[model samples]
Target: MRGILAGWDSLDPALRWLMRINLIALTTATLLLASAYLLGFRHTSVEIDLGVMAVSIVLMLVTPPLCRRYGAPAAIVGLTLSALIFAVGGTWATPNLSPLTALLTMVPLLVGFAYLGRRWIQVLSVVAVAGSAGVAALAEWRRTEAVSEEWWINAVVIAASLPAGVAVVVLLVRSAYARLQGQSDELVESRRRVVEVADAARRSLERDLHDGAQQRLLASSVTIERARKELRAGRHDSAAALLDQLAADNREIVTELRELARGIYPPLLTERGLVAALQSTARRSAVPVTLDVADVERTDPQVEAAAYFCILEALTNAAKHSGAAEVHVTLRGRPHLSFTVCDDGRGFDRGAVDAGGLLGMEARVAAAGGRLTLDTGPGRGTVVRGEFAP
Candidate 1:
């Protein structure tokens, strides 16, 4: 059942139409053969009736491919014409069987028309039921004396079968519509996530270029100018001090650039996985920090990385701006992996600091399919929490 559903879901709209048409044709042919047997074809010669059944089966089998190539409606019209020919022949030759055979013939038309929509389906269903009633009434009128057993039996079968067929076709149409809706929703969510990730990557690159490389170049130019002025004034000691300061500045630039690069894209994330990466970040932080990681083995890589960065950014902000004495980092990897960074510091209003570090952190977390929450106020400690799916 799953495999059949999967195959139906994967089919293109055009192919699905063809499949529906073919199934209708096959079912119609089966109904014709059953009607022939029920009407006692033994009264006629075996050779002649066998030839007629063979022709009907051949016509039904050949119609689907031609209909698929030309047009569905055109093909359906052709099938209806062929069934009408059979209906006329059965009514004249085997009079008692005509109503049941004609009613069965309407099944393909009703099922095929349902693909158009509810309005068309209703129109087709009404037409089919009315036409079947008209044919049964005509047959009843021909035998004016009394209702025969075969006529009553055929009438009961036609009444039960028509409604059951209609109900099954209605359910199939609803199922197809629901499946299409689900696929559309999935496509929308996938596109949204892709855009978020792309935007985050672009912003990270811009920030790194501005804060890391650009700052270093500006600092280098300043140091060179200072050294030149000191040398022109014949102050050897001052020039030497300026040169030493330039060398220290160069080292700082190199260190900061490496850190920025790693933050943008970390090799350890791909290698050691998320737990070790978070541990490494905690070890390198400036403040005295306590780290806790639980259920590390089950967490997804993307979720782990997002949680790690959220904590790293929170710790950096706490150390630099909050005047924090101690910071605690906690991570739990379960149904979802969650990270929390708490600090004992003079906390600032989260609303006031919306654009810079906090906003950037929020964007990063969101891009990773996660959320970041901040808890901070005047004179109180700050807590940063992030959660992501595994």
Candidate 2:
């Protein structure tokens, strides 16, 4: 059973539905037919009816592989053609009108409409409605005394067709709406995180300036006063040395400010795009880093920032926390921006994976409208993979 379902997770929505609907419809239809036979529903060709169903079931079984190989549209057309054949064949095999068989005709059209494009949906809707009316008209012309009791088959089919189409549209619209709502919530969450992180960044910047560059500047001012007095008193050599020291201090302050600015947002990430920026990071990393980056077209700065920071954070973990030697970083573009950071680090147990750094990484990815996943096990190493359409 496990082997049977091994590739099920990767199946597309249409293919998965094809499998599920086939199983469920086969089961339920079989039971309904057996019940109808026991209840003495007249059948002119029971063997032929069963033969059609048998052939359809065989075709249905082949659809999954075809769906996997050829994709959704062709598989859907195959499944629908099979259904259309069975419906016509089965109804003709019955003496009066197989009301059940007539109803089953709409299943293919509606399911196809759900999976196919808007044009296909429009085509299937017309086909279903016209087919319903035609089936009813056939029953009307063939209304003999034995079949007189099912004279309402036309009304039933017409009524069922309209409602079924409407129901499918309603369901599809609702699903699309729910997805939009989920996206809206994500945006709100992202906004909240940006606000909080921005506020924290401001405070951190203030503290760094006061503790680092500000004190150096104040000391330099006093040195300038002493240098002026020495020069005024004809101690030119000492004054010149003091001026030289002050010049070095000014250069150091400029370097410190640049580093602080880089911490907020790297200049390379904006100027050269993600791949170049990542290469820069790799060169600077203490751990031996190997990069497998494809040529990337520049994307949104925010998106590039997220990818940069995530990989940067991952590298930080590698250097400071993880007892690791080497790290591999991969990046791809075109279809969308994606990257992976893998480290030969001592991974933690899955149960104890609730570290703040990990949580921050996840939140950062989410804020950028992307998905991120972490794969790790103790002694197995850690992989942080992320993807987003920018």
TM-score of each: 0.42, 0.57
TM-score of 1: 0.42
Tens digits of per-residue lDDT for model 1, 318-350: 889889989988877543467889999999976
- Which 10 residues in a row give candidate 1 its minimum summed lDDT? 3-12
Best-fitting candidate, scored by TM-score = 2
* Model 1: residues with Cα > 4 Å off, grouped in runs: 1-212, 218-246, 355-363
Candidate 2 collision pairs: none
lDDT of each: 0.61, 0.67
Model 1 residue pairs with clashes: none
- Top lDDT model: 2
